[model samples]
Target: MSDMTIGKVAQAVGVGVETIRFYERRGLIEQPLRPKSGGYRVYPDETVQRVQFIRRAQHLGFSLREIAELLSLRASHGTDAIEVRQRATAKLQDVDHKIERLRHIRRGLMALLDRCPGQGPLRCCSIIDALEHDQRLASEPAERKEPDMQTVRLTIKGMHCDGCAEIVRHVLEQQPGVKGCSVSHENGEAKVAVDTSQTSGERLAEAVQGAGYSASLVTEAG
Candidate 1:
């Protein structure tokens, strides 16, 4: 068997070196064999293909643990129909759930797009008007006037317009420590200022997603 180093495997697979380390830590891949000759850890050239498999599975929404399970399944039963059927059934259910959600949203949008009042821009958009109402709660004088200077930026997706941006910002601003939050429709970025004493990134992300958006911590640089 041709020996390969971690860097060689990562290079061959088109992934960063750290990604291989993460796969090792996650138990999704095997560790390299460190020979007694001390020529640095050497892996089988097959590791490149394995890393490629992992990246493809991750894109398909398989978690690392699930990928490990899949590897185990493949090792034990390459042609077992029963186990394959069960895995397909579970994955199908996941797909069905997503499809159902999409269908519901499609129906709602059809109504909104067709029933849009022809009065004018401000008066015609039912979506924006509803979101504006949601943010009205923040205008209350009793709320905290200001929050600390700590800023968090969440990388978000699924925002198609200013309405979506407004909706996320309106929802995030309601959190206790969050004095203000704003989403850029152009870039799918959200800038927020919060007081650590009241709310955290977890809290803010939950709040934003709860309203209707996808978000996650991409970075936290000052």
Candidate 2:
């Protein structure tokens, strides 16, 4: 087998040099020892195949931990095809759940879009009106306000598009005591201003979860 430089190996495998280093760090692939007069570490052709295996496993929704297990199975003399198939089956179920959730989200957005006129004053647009109303309601003062409002940011996963962000913002803003809310699918986060006495970071997370997204508090404002 021909020896290859790190860059050459990465190029051959359609991965970056940093990815190769990361794989080495993750113990997914063994790094060859540097020669005494070496300017860079060299790898055997087998390393390219190993990196490709990692990439394919990732595309199949396997986490690095699971991929490591798969690699272990491959290295063992008594590898079980049934065990690998079981993992893949579980991954398929996860993907199915995600697809179902996405379909529900799509239906909701489509309903909203259907109600929209598609051409009108921004203020009169159905989608814009709904969003604006949510914002206005959220910003309205509570029956008793002592300025205990605080800001909180939460990282939300599964927001696949801008419409998902809008849905998340709308849902969060509807929560009692929310003063304002903003969500960004691109950033995968939601920022909310709420009356801590009437609501809380935990409640905000619950609202986000109800909206069909996984959420964790990123920052809590005092």
Candidate 3:
């Protein structure tokens, strides 16, 4: 075939051929021509332009769903600069929210660090005591339980907003034997119910902390 194919287009755009198919499936790119002479795939210069636009939007942090919407809008009448600005502004708000929450965690952790010099028994350590106390407090006020469910509460710190809760939930779900996890930013709690025989509270707590959130297991099993 004289004209380039999907493989060639993908190589030119630094993307996998499967990505090109995905873009087509997502309606971000139209199907290329099948030339009569060889019935081979053929890509025009415009296909390259569309591919670059997709890459650029992805680099700008647009989700695939969002990019598809933008591409649809463009195909009809093109997107307004105002709409682009609005999407960007919304993303900024999300980033700002995360930053503000992290700042709160940093302040609390720094204060705890300052109070405790990090050299003492686990019981004598102020930070550990504080963590335990906070964990204990978070365990309360969720007494109601659904049928067929066992409740376990974790005391987690460094959660600034609901997004942190999502992060906690996502991290916990990855662990083996973990059934499900629900994190609450308002209560500073991560409520998880898992197979006791497979997963331990200490291991789950460590996983939560590893996801950039501070957490500890409370002694109260109820």
Query: Using TM-score as the measure, which candidate wins?
Result: 2
Q: Judging by TM-score, tell me the better candidate of 2 and 3.
A: 2
TM-score of each candidate structure, all chains considered together: 0.49, 0.56, 0.46
96-196, model 1: which lDDT tens digit per residue?
66776666667666655665675687865776765566532122223233333466778788899999998888888788866556678798888776666
lDDT of 2 at 165: 91
* Ranking of predictions according to lDDT: 2, 3, 1
lDDT of 2 by residue, 1-222 (tens): 588999999889888899999999999999988889968888888898999999999998889999999999889987545456545655665677777666666766776788888886887788877676663222222232244556677889999999999899889889887766778799898777666888888888998898789998875342
* Model 1, global lDDT: 0.73
Q: Write the per-residue lDDT of candidate 3 for residues 120-186, one digit (tens) a residue.
A: 6777888888887773222222232223223457898899888888899899878765556667799
Give the Å error, residue 50, model 3: 1.7
In model 1, the runs with Cα more than 4 Å from the true position are 33-39, 77-79, 117-124, 132-222
Error of 1 at 45 (Å): 2.3
Clashing pairs in 3: none
The best-first sequence of candidates by TM-score reads 2, 1, 3
Clashes of 3: 0
Q: Give residue 179's lDDT in candidate 1 (0 to 100).
A: 53
Give the poorly placed runs of model 3, Cα more than 4 Å off.
Answer: 1-3, 33-40, 78-80, 108-116, 119-222
